[model samples]
Target chain A: MVPIAYYLVLSAVLFSIGVAAFLIKRNIITVFMSIELMLNAVNLAFIAFSRQWSQTTGHLQVNGQIFVFFVMVVAAAEAAVGLAIIIAVFRARNTLNVDQIDLMKL
Target chain B: MHLALFIIFAGLCVAGALNLLLQRHPINSALSLIVVMSSLAVLYLLLGAEFLAAAQVIVYSGAIMVLFTFVIMLLNAGKEERTHGSRLAYIAGFPGAAALLGLLTYIFLSHSATFGQARLGEYLATTDDISRVLFRDLLLPFEVTSVLILIAILGAVALARKEH
Candidate 1:
């Protein structure tokens, strides 16, 4: 039996890595991928908590998993719209570098 | 057995994430993200969310990643050029991430007893179980997501369409 804490620790580590990647990576697509990574990490935590509740209550609790399902749905929608915007930005600016696409930067 | 499986997949997942960060090319990064997603799907299975494990694989690895790869190829994205980005970002980002991880790890480890242990196969959330909740209890949100998807589709089409 794995301690639920272990799963939570793993999720935290993955999320921190995602945050680092999000901040450090310059490519817009890589940044987008990091966002996905963060979402995945949160989903893992949600499931871990769900399992913990089920273990303590002596029944299966589906709420956490259900939240994860909705998160996935939203993530899918976000990816579609985000990639399209990325494409449009690429077409207009002709580069994917975040630093160079600072038209709105003061 | 379950602990070992969890360690292996978790290690793979972290490695894939690090690879995604280190790789210079977007395509390479995309491939590593696929690796991460696949390992995550395995982790979901270990957590006894069988349906989510399948969905993670089919939706994330199969559908979303393919879309990413297609766009990467379409744009002809190249290896990222190194730039000495703002010094503040470099100084703040890594340490900030480490601090966040340490804080979370400390909290979880210190309070491990509250969370309890998760033995594999003890409590499985079958597809039938999940769908019942989704359709009956969460039916409104479920249907709303369909509308959300439609809006996203329209938005994507509008954004990506060529401007004559």
Candidate 2:
């Protein structure tokens, strides 16, 4: 039997890495990918806790896993709209670098 | 056996994420994210989330990441240019990130006993079980998500179309 806390640690590490990438990366798409990383980390935590709770409660509640499904759906939808916007911005500005796409200048 | 599986896949997932962070090309980063997602699906399977493992692979790696790659190709997003790091970040970022990681690790390790050891095959979430709860209890959100996906598709097409 693996300790649930191990899973928590792994997810936490992944989440922090995602945050670091989000802050340090300059390209918008990489930053976006980091956001996806954070989402996946949260999903991991949800599934881990769902398993833990099911183990303790003996009722087998799958609410957390179901929520993971909803999160995935939202992620897919966000990817579609977000990448489309990125493409549109590239067309208008001819670049995908975040620093270079500063159109909101005073 | 569970420990071995978790260790290997978790290592792969972390390596993939680190690769994603290090890669300058968006395409490479997307590929690394795919690696991370697939490995996470394996982890979900270990946690007895069988259906989520499938959906994570299908939706995230198959659909969402493919979309990212397509946009990267369409945009022809080149390698990111080297940029000078701010002095504050150079001095403080490394220590801050390390401190965050250490704190999280400490918290999880300290609470390990509160969460009992997870036995393999202890609680399997079957597809029927998931469907029952999802369709019965979460029907509204399910329908809303479908609508959201439809709207996203339409919006993507509207935004990505060639401007006359």
Chain A TM-score, each candidate: 0.99, 0.95
What's the lDDT for residue A90 in model 2?
A: 83
The docking quality of candidate 2, as DockQ, is: 0.73
Cα lDDT tens digits, model 2, B29-65, are 9999999999999999999999999999899999988
Off by over 4 Å in 1: none
Clashes of 1: 0
Number of backbone collisions per candidate: 0, 0
Query: Top TM-score: which candidate number?
Result: 1
Score each candidate by Cα lDDT: 0.93, 0.89
Q: List runs of model 2 lying over 4 Å from the truth.
A: B85-99
Give a tens-digit lDDT track for model 1, residues A9-63. Answer: 9999989989988888889998899999999999999999999999889999989
Model 2 clash pairs? Answer: none
Candidate 1 local lDDT, residue A74: 97
